[model samples]
Target chain A: MSTSRERVLARVRAALTDVPADEPVVRPVERPYADSHGMGAALEVLEDRLRDYKALVRRVPADRLAEEVAAALERRGASTVAVPDGIDADWFSRTEAVRRPDSRDRPLELRELDSVDGVVTACAVAIAETGTIVLDGGPDQGRRAITLVPDYHLCVVRADQVVDGVPQGVRRLDPARPLTWISGPSATSDIELNRVEGVHGPRTLEVLLVE
Target chain B: MSATFLGIPPFPEAARAAVNDSRLRHNLRKATHTIRDKRGAVVTELEDDWERLRSEGAAIKSHTLRHLDHYLEQLEASVERAGGHVHWAADAEEANEIVTRLVRATGETDVVKVKSMATQEIELNNALAEAGITAYETDLAELIVQLGDDLPSHILVPAIHLGRAQIRETFLAQMAEWGVPAPEGLTDDPRALAEAARVHLRERFLRTRTAISGANFAVADSGTLVVLESEGNGRMCLTLPETLISVVGIEKIVPTWADLEVFLQTLPRSSTGERMNPYTSTWTGVTPGDGPQEFHLVLLDNGRTDVLADTVGRQALRCIRCSACLNTCPVYERTGGHAYGSVYPGPIGAILTPQLRGMSSEVDEALPYASSLCGACYEVCPVAIDIPEVLVHLREEVAAGSGHLGEKAVMKGAEAVLGSSHALEAAQRAAGAARNLVPRHLPGMAGAWTDTRDLPDVPAESFRQWWNKHEKGQS
Candidate 1:
């Protein structure tokens, strides 16, 4: 029997017989769009966009990062926080919550992730124009479920990691790894096209922007 | 729970009923207008580059479609290399069978689903149910539609036709039957509703071992499938499941990874009118310890080749399903999605459904005429699909096909009369002389056209006669 793959490809080839034999398979596409908006205040812009999505954003200096994270988690009353593999231990040193570290060898169970009060992780890249933070399952970010299953997400973004636009953000990432690009907490406009936040994903997205 | 678009009335009949519906009209108007304004505001923010980005998006899709076979092979090879199995499905049945078998192979009867147009188009959920395998729709809108036993009206918001009150009622009435019961005091507040859905679906996401999804864009170079969504259900389904199956339309391919820059920038703005939707998940294949352990990609053709066959019609394949066209369409805003009677509705549906399904059915034939050809859809389309051009092209195809014998005969006679000056003048004179004898309504099937419209009164004399008299000074 002929494989469906062969049959589908055959149909496709048969359908496109009009193309010239010499036509290049890949042609240069014109991109007149700018690579970057060149908004020099990418951090401020990122903050504004993040706040616009109702995500709580706080900027702190490098030395105050751990203190701010601890305060934010305390404010949220998060008693149990899931920490990814490579997240700095110092960042949670001042926190009162018990740390549950997730690693490849000893990953947290789905129930444990669900039961955790919050999750803390680092991002791969942040897009200023869209206010999106991308996680590529890096050691610091751990598995995608760590930030997802939990109701609260405390993502740390560095000032240096922010890109001015989506194009710049896309160019900086590797597609081979699984990536979760989150702009805000999960939202929906399904009911009468009204924007409603905090659905399925974490309800609270608190970003600690370390300069 | 088995709601389908099958056996729906044709566009004219369906649209007439829809237009008369006051509540549906109010909901559609409010929703479409809100999104339209939001889209305008966000799109204007990129005023300097929006058009260029849209053109670039169109060019990239065109380039990919022209060499689709090459890219499909590349995508398949890349996916396999990334430890994901690739299955080719010629049509809906093949795709559904493959998904069902894959689920059964895992000995799992239940699978969580991200909102996917491809799966909806193939009715995968229905197929799974037939095999005694239940598929849970995890998207809030999809969940509402599934629980309410309703067909999806809009592409982005499947239950766009239903208001918040209706949703709360649905949850209160049906949530328990599905899984978790809705809270007793659940109000119609959008936040409370969203919270209810989150709480209800959380258990399923954590428990369901298998998931099915669809891709917004499939990067051929990297074998990456990207799904941009506002809610996190997509992330849960893509991440938590042990075995992931994505049934993707073949046309969802982008030639390169860098090409995502064009679509990612345009899609969110064009879709939910956000700078970026809340969540976008991208996965190439199975990651060892991070996401799904096993991944299967089913490439679906299902009339896409037929769509590709027509050079003019092939542009419909460029659609990203952003649905900006639907929100901006005047005809769509009034009649809403159900009138088009396809999973895809609005201007895209008018051209797309007919091409995908062929113009054999009354619904398909009427779809090409569903538009006023106002060009609003083309203006807002992120990929720049010239919807009006396709509508006219499809109209011509539908007209040339079988049926409409009476209309065809009338057109043929009128063609001869209008083709010659002598015949036209004589016919005009005859019409003028017999003006009083002409009935207001035509006989038989021809009356259908004049039923809701008035026939133009015959002029006392044709324009040609007046022109001749003035030129000859014989007025």
Candidate 2:
């Protein structure tokens, strides 16, 4: 009748009996590596890294944000776009496709997102060294599903949000929020370790950086 | 869906069969070399900082293990506060039962799975099938493994042993039995194979209400579970399901959220050799309107505590399962994972399997000897697990075990002679006099050594006697 939890904890305590009785449980963690891989122009380097992952990267001035987003959508020949509820409305105003706003009360059905051609949202932070963008369910970025179920993800990253590496990016985010770090489109290396783009998540990741 | 690896032979016997399969050897060589080269390149790009990063990774894991019971309790409290249910499983059976029951509670018969080594270690899919629940493997490599009715052969790529042509045949012949059939004219191309898997699992992802996952790391402070993967199959299973069950090992915990920065950098670089893998998703507990509404975490021990009991062997706990060791291992490159006879394979497997499962069975007993003590695994390990040291330590445990009476007797006799210089000298002199009678193949207790190795010709005078006469003296 003994619960497995108690039994497991008992075994663990007995196993670690060799650990000192008087020493502090938590020790200061040593971090010898640099905070970031030092390279000037982190934003420009971020663009290069993103493109290396086969992601389409475009840097547009703040004034042309809507034009750039619409052009990227048009290139994909998207007929409909699923936009997260709190994203910048102006970013998609110039697009000719019908815009479907995510429901506030409930999640959009998988079939509904499956039918859409593209999705666009704002990123919380970008790691320039790895060419990665993180999505924390912000006002612009809805839940995890809106960007996931769609075939294409056109994430918008601002230059000010670019960090030098992972440490800087982690310092700026909240772990309580659901965070998704995406370097490129969904890819698989299961077949002989050869990376092939397009899988369960978005098949194509297009990043638009506004200065 | 419930294929068991019961009655599998010990490591040496299985390896004997594996090494002879030239096609399998070729497949393994190609796959491992490709990943090894890629990992080497990416790791080298970090320049001088790589070694420091590896040391810090090892130190962090060691500190966690020193106070594991404390961190686990903290992790439990954090998880409960986040509106998630926490279950502790002492071993594989207990963990499997907990997960199966959670799924049945949802009243859903179909579940989708991400590629989790912990689930594979516990054989959760088999346990669920026993409870009349079907679990579909959504990872492309895992799907190939399930369809082919075989065990996972590698940690990263489960189907590393199967070439493209073999996979094409598996898809054309087996995909229909699982769900959607392969499209007409499917080729051996990797893209076609990947596309076929994507198509096959898409409908299942949309429909399945329950998901079973295993996490790479769990933060004790935030109750967050992190999963890193190259494909989005993990993301699909993680996001789509209504009920989520994650089975994680107790050792997967790191102290704080910031600790993720180290592993997130090292893992992707060491594992698939990318600067960052395609997707990494971190979620804590349940969100009201997003992803899974209910969450359950089953923390598994499964002889991990027993593993921690040994001072030298406990270093194996530092492993993050990046599989850099496997890719660099010479013995693993030839013999393949099937030789190790456990869910974990390669150098890490040699030490880890025996500790987790104990040295009771022939396979577990043979595992410590599977390695050549090359130290390549240690050099490439992101966490710096000294696999060769653990192998020798486990070999001592096996030698001192109940089954090896002959080996024990030989060691006792060796202790008598080797312990005393006089006894050693007399024995050496006697053998020196009988030098001409020495055989190429030794007999009796010594045959085990001499059958595979030639006995050295004894000199006219032993070292001690020769040294006594000359100034190069042994007093």
Candidate 3:
């Protein structure tokens, strides 16, 4: 029998026989939409959008990020935090939580990460309009597992990384890297279509925005 | 019994039972209205460019479908180059066989699954069960369907037909048989129900060696596959599994990365009424020591090429499976989803099922007439599917079928009578003379129409006669 690949392609050709073979493949479509919808300052919009989703949002001066991070973790009463390497070590100096740094050669097991109280990581880019933060497994972000398995997530986003909309965020992202876009703590609408926060991933998401 | 049934009766017959089921009617009404209201509120907040985004989405899809052969080949080559293996399956059977074989080769008996419509279209879970591999559905809604032994009713929330009380009962009664039992004293609260699911699926995610999923979008320029979900269960399945397999339909492809701007803005709001979902994951291929080590992509056709053949019907391929049309459809709201007898239910199904599966089944033939043609679906469709146009087209096809001979003859007679003045005049005179004798319920073929609707009383006088008798009217 002919391979499924050959058969499927033949069917596709038969299906689109009317679409001229010589016809141009890339028909220019008009994306007349603005690059981003700017309501106000990106930082202000980001904080408002994040708060709307019930996520804890805090903005602090760049120099005071370490103090803010320590305060947030203390507020959550997290005793242990899974931190990625290359994250500024000074950020966790004030917090008494056992800082377990993720290792590249010996990655933390999912169960071990699950036992930790929370995770602290840096973001790749943040979209202010949608209140989304993208993680591309950059040095400070670590692998997808460390952030996912923990019950709480404390992601630090710099003011320079924030954009106004999804289009701008996409332009800045490298598609080759695995990307995770998060808008809020994990939520589900499956039960009678009720939107309830806290289903699977980290239930509490605290964002420490540094100007 | 699971809404998970197959080869059922025609839609009208099936709908008769659902229309009378007060509980289902109540459940569907509550769920659909909630989503509809939420969707309306968020969409109204858009910055005057929602229409532009919709048009951009439609144009991008149109361009890709027209040149699908080229884009699909590019996708396959790119995926292979990115350290992922790709397989093409011409139909559901071939796709199921390939997936089952892949599982068999892994030497594993159990696998974790993310909520995937493509796999549901092929009934992958059932296929895997027959092959002696138990696939655990990790999504909260899917877990409800699996435990309740029900078919998915809605695309976004598969168990939308079951209320909270019923969900509590399902968890209490069925959790132990599957795995970890729900905590005792569980109530109908949504938060408690979600918590139980999280704990129940956590163990499976940790232990399962294989994961299966479907992609919401596949970018052709790169080999990336994107899955959007609210709960973290998808994150667990995508991240923790040692090997990952994704089955995606051909129509899910986009030509480039930039096109995501259109869908990303529209899908989350249209689906769950959120500015953005909680978790959206995009992966190009297998990365060294990250996520899944072995990645496989199954490109499924399964009658999509057939649907794409009809120039008029192929527009159904543009569906992003947001379920916005289902939530807004009046017909869908009343009958719920089970009446449609397909995984894809409601307005999208009315056009898509008949094209994908053909008019051979009575259910497929009846689906074309399931709507009131209110045009609500067209208004809400993000990709601009002209639903009424496709419904009328499908109606023409159904009307031309063998079963409709009697109705066809009656329509032809009515047309001939209306065409000539003499035939019309005579018929009107005869009807006027016997107006009192007309039955409220007609017999035989006409009974199908009169059974649910009262036949109109024959008028006492024809319009032409009234016009001819009025002198100058103004006088």
Candidate 4:
């Protein structure tokens, strides 16, 4: 009869009871480097690194962003796209593709969305050095299954949302939230030490470096 | 079909048999070295704060273990609240009985499995087999191990002792007897082998109604269980089944989601040398219609409470089963997992198996002496467990009364000679006088050591005699 929140809190308390309350929770330290001239240079470095990991990156002006995204989807020949509730309407309204909201659908509908070519959503935060995008199951990110089921994911992130390192990202995240940190596409290696890509999760990831 | 690691021979006997096989040694050397080098390179890339992260991981585990009783109760209550059942088992028999009953209640004769070492340590597959239920291993390595009818030799790479050609032979000969058959004339190529395995497992993935798993970490706060792996097989097994059962050891609990950050970094890098694992499946209770409709968690003790009772030995429970220590161990490299005579093998096995199952058998007693106390395992252990220190402690325990009769006698005789200055001096004088009579090759019981190595020549004069003739005059 106890609520999920109560259960989680009780466990946390018990696990931490033996340690001193004042003990510092250590966070990873970021290595020092020369500061970028501005957010643009940092964004460029992020884009470069993301490209190095084989993530597709594109830059668009604020006014023409929706049209560019729609065209990108069309180029991939996608008919339907899963859209989070908080995503800007103009992004899909301007496109010819059908938009499916993750909140209103059941498992069957989600499976249907998997057959579609892609899913587009805004990210909570991005790490530049590791080329990781974190989706916290917030309104924009929708359900965890939405991004996970789709073959291709197009995540939108503003330049300011980018952090220099994992430690900085950890500081910004709430521990209670459902967080998914993605570096690149899902991959695995066999016993013979041969690497294979795209077994589960997203096979192809396209990140729109919207400034 | 017994769950015990009983009737297993001593380490030297088992290893002597394995080392003579040139093919097994070649496969083991190649696989272990490749993984070792890749792990070292990736770990060195984060050279700035690697040690700090390792220390943080160890501290978090230590903090959680110190209050495990409290966290475990909280977790049980939470699971109950979520309409999921929780069962506590003290040993392997109790655990197997609980699971067998649960599965029997579900009226299912088959169950899918995630790659879980705790379950393997208890030999759950064999237990289930005796009960007339079939448990399929979904992890590729585990599948290979099960189908080949062989024991796992390495923690991560269970089939490390076999090469690609051997795997092809195993699949071609045995895959049909299990559930699926390999394609006609399957070659020794790695891709062909993987495609064949994929085809073989896909049917079982879609059909199995019940699933069993072991966790990487269990968050007591939310009663959330996490399993991280490189393949999608775990995700499929976790989500598709109607009823899911997880048998996790108590030591796997972490305080909160925040504590997961340290392990997420350390485990992937240390185990597979990857920056991140491909599939990280996290589920809490039933997610309505998203995953398995019914969930049961069997929290296993299985001599863990005994391990936890020992202040120094308790750190062995902090292991995540990453197998980093195994890859880096020199002893494990030459002799392999089969020599350890237990499911848990290598350096971790040397310390853990003896403690979990007491040093009551010849194999268990010899396990402590399996290592050279080289400290390589300690260096690579993510939790910073001083494995060599534990090995030495177990050796002392074995020397007193816990070891085999022959070993205990040998230690006692050695102690009598070395324990006193007069006895040691007198023994040294006797040995020096008998130098001419000493044979180059040892005879009888001592021959095993000389078989692989040359015997050291005893000098005509003892160091004591030489010192007395020269430097003693000055005194």
Candidate 5:
């Protein structure tokens, strides 16, 4: 018997017999859409959009980011926080929560990760238009599971990392690494089509934007 | 008994029953309208760029479909290079056998699932059960459908046909049979219901060794598969499992990684009416210690090649499964999804199902006529699938194929009469002479058409008679 791959490809070829044999394999896609929305105050729009999605956002000076991060953790009363490697240790200096540092070499077990009160990490890039933050499993992001299993997530975003639109954000990322794009706290419209926040992922998302 | 699409009535019969059920109609009306309004608001936010983005999206998909054979080969090669094993299945049976064997090889009996239409289309859960394996649906809506022994009715929310009160009852009664029990005295509040599901599925996500999923998009250049979802259950299944198998339709491919920019913006607003869904996860293949250690991508055809064969019907393959058309369709709003009798329902389904399954069965034959050609589905489609055009095309194919002999004969008789102006004038005079004798409804097979419609009132005389008399008086 011919392999399923060969058979499937044969079927596909036969199905497209109507197409000209000399047609080009790739055609340029027409992109009349704008690359960015050119928002005058992208950070303010980000804050507004994030708030609309039920995500808490705080903007602070670069020097005060650790203070804001510490205060946010304190506000959530997270005594045991999972901190990925490369995150600033100074950010946790004010908070008394025992930090569990996770890395690719020494990753926390699933059960331990689940038991943490929250996870703190840096974002690869942020889209202000959609209020989304992308994580690429960088040194500070550790692994996908660490951020997912916890009930609370505190993501720190530098002002420079924010983009004006989805297209700009997509252009900045490397697909080779696993990426998670989060707009807000996990939500669902599955129940009677009403939007309800707080499902499986972090119920509370606190973003500290350092300008 | 578990709900199955098999042995279901055809569209007209099922739709008649659905239209009369006040409760189902009320639920569907409320759900579709709410999403429709939300989608309008979000799409309007990008008014200047929305049309351009839509056109670009259509162009990209059209180009990809034309060169699907070349892109599929590239996708296969890229995935293999990314440390993932690729399998090809020409149909559902072959796909199921491959998945079942993969699970058994892991020596695991329980596997968790994300909400996947492809899996639902193939009835993978049933096949897994036959192989002595259990599949747990972790998405809240899917879990409800599983627990209540019901079929999914909507593309986005599977249980849209059931109200919150019904959901609470199902959870309270059936949740225990599954892993966890619902809290006592559970109310019908959506938030409370969501909390109960969170507690119920947390343990299973931690324990399941293998996971099943479907991709929203697969990039040929990067070998990456992306899944966009609102709930975090998808995150858990994609992240925590030891072995992961993704069943993807052959048409879900984009040529390059950058092609995601268009869909990433349009899909969320079109489907769930959000700026962006809560979670969008993209992974090329195995990520060693980060995600699943072993990755297997099963590429499925399942009669898609047959859909591609038709020049007119092939546009349905560009669908992103957004459900935007469903929300905007007036006929769908009244009849709900169950009446369509396919895993896919609504306008896209009406055109897609008949092509994929072939117009052999009554259900498939009935689907093409399910629409009223309102054009709302085409207006709202993100990729711009001309749903109404396809409906007409399929309708013509069905009418020309078999049955409908009575209707065909009537059309032939009309054609013979209308072919001659003299014959038409005489027939019109005969109809005018017997105007008072005509009944309110036609008799025989034609009565079915007039059952829900009124025949036009006949004039006292034909246009020719009136015109001739008025001309003589003027002369």
Candidate 6:
């Protein structure tokens, strides 16, 4: 059996063959003002855009992060939360809600996470221009099922982690990683052009932009 | 896959029949306009570096296609490493045979399906039906199409051609034949339609142990297959089945997980005009007892390599099936997908179907001329596939064939006149003398051009004569 690593390398070699060796690896393009702005500015812009698209956005800080998350959970009346392995233990140390670690949870166990109030995890990268957050099945991200099962998800992203463009973000990731990029809460607009959020994945996504 | 464009007709005949269907036109206009407006607004809102992203998307796809052989090898290795089996099929029949055999091995009579265009393109469900295996379409639009016994009319919204009333009727009449019957006293209300569909599909989702799917993207690095959908049905299909068979086009490869970053932004915006689709499902073979226990990915060629062989036409392979091009295309907006006479329709279909199937069939030959060449499809294309360029290229191929007898005659006459200045001068003089006899309307072969459109009143005077009278002396 061909290894995943070998497959990735072979594709990379093939894709890159046409590129001139001397060409700059990362070419910068002029993004709109909202895209080129710094993380804080971009986050606000994203908030506005999301609101325009009818998605709700809430902001929280690092020091009060756990309490705020707990409060958000309480507001939604969640009984349990799916916690990724890489999430800082301190984030959940103060919360009273039961925790479900992604690694140990089976489908049935994960289904319980869906009934629980919400899911909380850290994002791999967030694109400010497009209002997107990417989650690789990294330490903090956990299995793909955890975040998807819950109705609500509170994804935390550090300001430094946000990127202006997809290419810049792609440069930082390894091909072998399992990446899930999200822009807004899961949504479908089949009925008379009226959008219904939370069809399969999280119905509500609350991003905690920690400065 | 064998590149054979067999048994298809030319565009004029197909479009001639379509334009007469007023209901189809109304359905198309409503659907395309709504999607076009939504896509435009969302895209404009996320206009930050849209062009850059488009270029990046194109580049990534181009890079992947160039090294597809390598990537396929890598993806196979990764899936195997992850305890998954990989099978390759050269054409639709081969793919159908392989999938049928796989399902037979599992001894399953029914399989739930995720919204997969690849399977639709190859008509896998029908093939399975011939083998006495039933395939249930899980996506809402797909369900509508399947229940109606109709072809998909749009890439993103497969049942865009069906209105609420029509859906209500189709559901009321057809649901019992499939498995579940629609709720009694069903109304034309959208909620009722959705609820009936929901209750009906939920049973299948819960019951089916085998599922078939098509991937949005396949990451070679991790042997991961990704599927993006608006509904949770795809998730259920991918996760609930005991044996999951994913039939993916070979062109749907991305080198790494990171490469997915570019597409995630481009696809949702370009397809549904949303910031992101609700469900983005990714899996690397089997995950022990978590999802499907036995996972199989059938890598389908089905004329993709033939598409790859053409330098200009090969770019059609980079399509993410976003359907932005379809929504914005004027011809597609009017004639709809049915006119193209293939699974793939609209701008991408115009270029892709011809290449994959070749300019052999009347339908395949007619596909290249289906577009108006207005470049709207090119502008909305997330990957920036110069579809107009490809359309013209395919047109040239079609024109070279014997089918375009009238156009060939006109071209030959024009070439002869243009080849010699004296011959052109003689023709221009002859045209001036014959202006009265030019007949406001042409007969027979040239009549179709004036059927729906006004033939430009044959210029009162030839351009050469006018230029000579006005500016020749000044020069």
lDDT of 1 by residue, A1-211 (tens): 1399999999889888888878998777566798877656999999999999999999999999989988998899999999897988999878788999998789999888988999999999999999999998898999988999898999999989999999899999999989999999889999888888888889889999999
- Compute DockQ for each candidate against the true complex: 0.80, 0.71, 0.77, 0.18, 0.78, 0.20
TM-score of chain B of each: 0.89, 0.88, 0.90, 0.89, 0.91, 0.89
Looking at model 3 chain B, report the run of 10 residues with the lowest lDDT sum. B445-454
Give candidate 2's chain B TM-score: 0.88
Residue B383, model 1, lDDT: 92
Error of 4 at B270 (Å): 1.4
Kindly list the per-residue Cα lDDT of model 4 for residues B239-333, writing each as its tens digit.
Answer: 66789899998789887665666787789788887655655666677655456778999887676766776777878988988889988888888
Relative to the true structure, how large is the alpha-carbon lDDT of every model?
Answer: 0.91, 0.88, 0.89, 0.75, 0.91, 0.75
Candidate 3 lDDT, tens digit per residue, B1-475? Answer: 1235476766766776777789999999999999999888777777578888888888899889888889999999889889999999999999999899998988999999999999999988888998999999989999999998878889999999999999999999999999999999998899999999988988888899999999999999899999999998898889888889999999999999889998999999898888899899999988787799899999999999998988999899999999999999998998888889988999999999889887768788888888889999999998999988999999998887765565777788779999999999998989888999988777776554454345788888878777877856847
Candidate 6 lDDT over residue span B1-475, tens digit each: 1111223345565666677789888877887777778888767765566777788788888877776766778889999998899987777888899899999999999999988889988988878988999998878788888888877877878888777889899999999988889999999776667767776876676678899999999988889889888777777787767899999998998887766767877898888877667567777877654568899998887777777777788899999999989888888877777767777888999899878886667678767777779998888888889999998988888777777677677778678889998998887788778777776445666654433343465566788888888896787
lDDT of 3: 0.89
**Judged by DockQ cut-offs, is candidate 4 incorrect, acceptable, medium or high?**
incorrect
Per-candidate clash tally = 0, 0, 4, 1, 0, 12
Interface RMSD of 5: 1.2
Chain A superposition TM-score per model: 0.96, 0.95, 0.96, 0.76, 0.96, 0.74
**Candidate 6 lDDT by residue in tens digits, A85-132:** 668888876678887766624333634664677788998877666676
Give the poorly placed runs of model 5, Cα more than 4 Å off: B410-443, B447-475
